[model samples]
Target: QYLCAIRPKDGRLVLSTMVYADEVNASDDIAELKAVSETELPDKELKMARQLVDSLAGDFDAERYTDTHRQKIMALIERKADGDTGLVEAPEAEAAGEVVDLMAALEASVAAAKDARKRHPTGVDEGEGEGEATTPEKAVRKKKSA
Candidate 1:
């Protein structure tokens, strides 16, 4: 529903993302992924996965997120226009193929999301009105003035 272009095909609605498929590259990235049917997965694993997703139901709304990346870019442009000489340093490169603890990460995320929900039950962030969902101070840090 979020996609701009959608068309009806054989009584089913499908997203028309491109006008032409000439530039499309249907390579290994697409071919490598295979959907595992419910029958293929063990019942216990399927049930646990479903339960985990159910627990995170309230935390995964698309509307709750703001485009922080775009906002940062816009802010940088404004800073440049205002004659601010600060150099926008490139972010440090991360280690290639770092293994992560998925379960621990998920648990931490759940805890943080639940805490945020408790703080704001309506899902509307506190500082969203001024074109940001987070505090301006947190978004751009400056040196303390004596």
Candidate 2:
């Protein structure tokens, strides 16, 4: 039997192999397989770049992210599976006929998003029932009521 072990030695990673045998001298069979050098110390430019990246890093909260488009598609599939064909067709996107003022368009989009956030603080649309009761009875009641 052979066992491989890794350890840090002189700021480098050393891989050592040990042999275990019932009838053989294990010490004579043991070998220092290889040593992997540590990463080189960062240069001034690399240090600056690393610092810039570290400064931009922030805590990641996965709960704050959602695939709304995918959720919508799944909901549509569910509705179709349930034999509900009253799906609303989305309006066609109009082509950009001419060059638009980029800054003005960006400002308008920002303002619209702000207004939407104010209207739906929970980020859920009205009648979407995002936080509603999930019991089967409640679901049936909601469907009947609707």
Candidate 3:
């Protein structure tokens, strides 16, 4: 029901009642109704407002989005089920070439040795055994095993 409060002086419209259509367009004046004081809202108006809020709360269609990984997996599964035995071809093997540069090889070896020393600082290099004596003392003397 449309309402109008007429001014007594010149019979002009002072206030108009709030409107709510069955299906409100995206660009409607819902802001005016929102500004209305909670105490001033009639029970019917409050109910309608609650209904409108509830209607707008959830409207997303989750089915519209596709999971690409899942789709690919499903396709592979279906292919396997139907015995689609086509395998993707592997690349042709090419002839292996030597490194060819001596200085570059030495640099790489030095770098690797430095990295190994960094990994184990006090560790023995190459031929040194823990229980074995040093070679310097045995240089001038020969030992007889008992």
Candidate 4:
């Protein structure tokens, strides 16, 4: 396995590559790579950014997430195989008026996110309990309510 970090330099991106060996060797390799890169490049900002990144490094966990879109696609395939038509009209896209103030939009987004967190403390919807499948209508209603 290999870990790579990309940072913006000038007008492009520069990648710092490091190979992963054993646990001990991986840390040594990363440190050596960083040292070599830092010595070759005399950019204080990049050096500081690299140091900050190294300080925040942690183990990679792959099992903590699920691909909902892939799951939904497979479910739809199964339904079609079972003689279901599986036809649904796509929702109309809402027109977003011109965004004049980026700061206000960002602030509104943060406020909305905080409100949502308070509404759903567990980060799960009311009817989204384990093994309790949510239908399209239920999903639409939930979004409308929100």
Candidate 5:
């Protein structure tokens, strides 16, 4: 809403903003407001107003947040001291010849399914394989299927 002071001689109305939608019954110094209404407000006055609001409503608490990574590192160091052997697997390097050929074929098949939406005009979706089995027995079965 606007507070309008209309001049009777002319049709023009002098408009002044009263309050914002979010600010419910916000307090202001009437004397300073009246003074500024006639003149211009200074940057020092604006900064002081912001400082007053922050002093009344803002809470400064540092202990509310905790460092999770530091805690995890400390726990891992303790486990290392106790001689705990974690199940860490070494990454396999790229294979050569026939192995590379088979890997390329599998990758191409997967790519075809993933990019089906882009290739097909009618937008027919295709599903992906849920990877090769984990156990040795299942791995053997998977190799037999290939």
Candidate 6:
């Protein structure tokens, strides 16, 4: 078999890959990319990016997060075998909100994040303990204190 992951010599593998997104305007060279820093980014964009990351940041609950479609399909198969169609109808999904512009998407994300926080104040599902929540601000503060 070909070794795509680990190298026996160093016990590590390096990766070089491009992102799947064609919309993102990325520079050809790493040097070109490194030339730009957060300071150079517009205040609005930087702030939104920070907010987006902060809001989305959380410990993923393996028990909760899963491939719902696959689960549904399996359940559907079971139901079909048992001569029943137990709630496996394909549900309507929103159209892929393809990014026409990055800034607009960022703004929408910020708004959505705020709304999500409002809905789940503890950043987890209802009745869950606060131990699951981890904000970037809190983590940074903790590190500084330590």
Best by lDDT: 4
Candidate 2 lowest-lDDT run of ten: 19-28
Clashing pairs in 2: none
Backbone clash pairs for candidate 1 read: none
Worst lDDT 10-window in candidate 1: 30-39
lDDT by candidate, in order shown: 0.54, 0.55, 0.51, 0.57, 0.48, 0.50
Candidate 4 lDDT over residue span 1-146, tens digit each: 34576544333334544432322232334444555434554589767877776676555443444556667889888888999985856879999988688899899998898568546534544456664533343333335563
Which stretches of candidate 6 lie above 4 Å from their native place? 1-10, 14-65, 85-88, 93-146
Q: TM-scores of the models, in the given order?
A: 0.28, 0.35, 0.21, 0.32, 0.24, 0.23
Q: Global CA lDDT of candidate 6, please?
A: 0.50
The positional error of residue 106 in candidate 5, measured at the CA in angstroms, is: 34
| lDDT tens per residue, model 6, 77-132 | 88899999566457699899755988998999988886797565357543556557
lDDT of 2 by residue, 1-146 (tens): 34454433354344444322222332324344222232455579556755665575444333555556667899999999999989579879999799889999999998898578546534544355755422332323335553
Task: List, residue by residue over 45-123, the lDDT tens digit for candidate 5.
Answer: 7577556555654332334444565677788788888998895456597786554678889999988886874454444
The root-mean-square deviation over C-alpha atoms between each candidate and the true structure, in angstroms, is: 25.0, 27.5, 26.2, 23.8, 24.9, 23.2
Q: What TM-score does model 2 achieve against the real structure?
A: 0.35
Better of 5 and 6 by TM-score: 5
Off by over 4 Å in 5: 1-57, 88-146
Top candidate, metric TM-score = 2
Candidate 1 per-residue lDDT over residues 16-132, each given as its tens digit: 434223333333234232232213666797577667645643322334445566679999999999999988899999879978999999999988986786465345464456333
Q: Which ten residues in a row have the lowest lDDT in candidate 4?
A: 19-28
